[model samples]
Target: MTKAERALETRERILKAACEVIADIGFENVSMRKVAEHAGVSKALLHYHFDTREKLFAEAMTHSFAQTGTDLDGGDADVPAGVLLARIVRTMLPTDEELRQDWKLWQELWVRAQRDDAARHLAVDLYDQLHAWVGGAVERGVASGEFAPCDVAAISTLILALCDGLGIRVMLADPRVDLSTAQSTIWSAIAPSLGISPAFPET
Candidate 1:
């Protein structure tokens, strides 16, 4: 790889390490030294690449949701929008070992954001992406007559708030918080609000 590519890779490595450390521990407990150690890089190198811990954490949040970037940006909805929407809805449900780590990391970030402005900014960005995706879907649903003529923006914001709030609720509760059930419940609630039968499949 070229120098530029190598530098980018190293930067990503540091961010991932920082995210994992914060996930394993709490963000309040995280240190640049710890992240450097986790990345197997030197402290000087961490500072050289990111300059500050907040920047590293912010970049990590972006990297964490990189896979959803296209959809979150309101690009073309993935085919079979219902299935895609359902999949996105299920993002909060971490069933496997790997996903559980991602979930824990985000949970840590959320708690940290309560006090840290940088963390709060990251939280806002996350919700904004979800708003764009859900709002686009709602607009399309209205155009297709699948939903009643309603305020797409408001409904989208409501969906995001519900989804995000419920995720936090489940995270704090006992292990029995069934995310699948939560997804289903939200969908049912949304269907009626959009003037569709709960059983009606998306067009």
Candidate 2:
């Protein structure tokens, strides 16, 4: 491959390694050297790509989210909006191993954001992206007449907050709150507002 391609590959490797390291251990315990070792690159090369641990952490967290492939637009037009929204809600939870790891990274960011200004900003920016995606789905549902006209922004915030609360329980292996229960609870709470059934869509 060309030099640029190689560089891009290395950068991606480092970011993936960073995500794994930070998720395995707490972010506070991770070092650039540790990430470099995990990525099978020299410390100098890691530094060349990301000058600081904070920068690396930010990018790693963003990378982890992007890996989910959750998009804001252009799903199967034939799919009902409720089904599409249900799919998006399911994706936000730690239903599988990869999502579990991604959730761990999010937990790390939550802890770091409490004290680190940069991390705080990153958290807000990431939330904004999530909000846009969820809100867009809600708007689409309304426009398609599959959902009742309501406050889209408020509904989006409520859905996200519910997911955050229930997702933590699922991640912690709370027997009372399995993935299905969490999903159903969210659907039940919001379905009335959207004029849809409380049942979680099979999709």
Q: When superposed on Cα atoms, how far off is each prediction in RMSD?
A: 3.3, 1.4
lDDT of 1 by residue, 1-203 (tens): 99999888998899789778877887778899999999999999899988887788777777776644345325554454454445566664554445566677777778879998978888888878768877776777677665688887887776676666666656666565566556666678677668765542432
- Which residue pairs show backbone clashes in model 1? none
**Candidate 2 local distance difference test against the native:** 0.92
List where candidate 2 sits over 4 angstroms from the true fold. 71-75
TM-score of each: 0.81, 0.96
Residue pairs clashing in model 2 are none
Error of 1 at 159 (Å): 1.7
Q: With candidate 1 superimposed using the best TM-score fit, by how many Å does residue 168's alpha carbon deviate from the native?
A: 2.6
Q: Which candidate is the best by TM-score?
A: 2
Error of 1 at 61 (Å): 1.6
Cα RMSD of predicted structure 1: 3.3
What candidate 1 gets wrong by more than 4 Å, as runs, is 68-78, 95-99, 173-176, 197-203
